[model samples]
Target: MEPEKLRKRINELAAKKKKEGLSETEEVERAALRAEFLANFRQAFRSQVEMMQVFDKAGKEVTPEKVREIQRKKGLRDD
Candidate 1:
């Protein structure tokens, strides 16, 4: 399912759970949806972190070596 729909369904399931509780099947579906959401969230956050550049007041790069290596591998930086 698409991200938006997945989120919507998850919220629906949560509301149902809060008001009346879920069936076993609905509980399983909610668990799967939660896992998918977390995986997507982690990947997006990692991508943003990988693309970042940190600098100091002196105008020199201060990005960590590990982050720079990841950016280099992704072709976002050259040095």
Candidate 2:
């Protein structure tokens, strides 16, 4: 999902939890989930920044096809 949508959902969940009065264990779970979400966001942003750096150095467009090919050669698949 998009970051904005994910953030909205997280906020809604947090509000619901606050309304319900979360236990310590539930709070820990929420913290873990939030940390994981932020980590994923950071990784995605880092990959984008790296791609931009590559383009700046190479002075060429980084096509989606090239990205897909790299992922394919690395044995990574959506399935």
Best by TM-score: 1
Provide the lDDT at 24 for model 1: 100
Question: In model 2, where do residues sit more than 4 Å from their true spots?
Answer: 1-12, 53-79
Predict model 1's lDDT versus the native.
0.95
For candidate 2, lDDT tens digit of each residue in 1-79?
5667667767866997979877787677678668878998899985674343234456775446666555566565342
Q: Residue 12 in candidate 1 has what lDDT?
A: 100
Candidate 1 per-residue lDDT, tens place, 1-79, comes to 7899999999999999999999999999999999999999999999899999999999999999999999899888879
- Backbone Cα, N, C clashes tallied per candidate: 0, 0
Which candidate leads in lDDT?
A: 1
lDDT score, candidate 1, position 49: 92
Q: Which residue ranges in model 1 land beyond 4 Å of their true spot?
A: none
- Give each model's whole-structure lDDT: 0.95, 0.67
RMSD of each: 0.8, 7.5
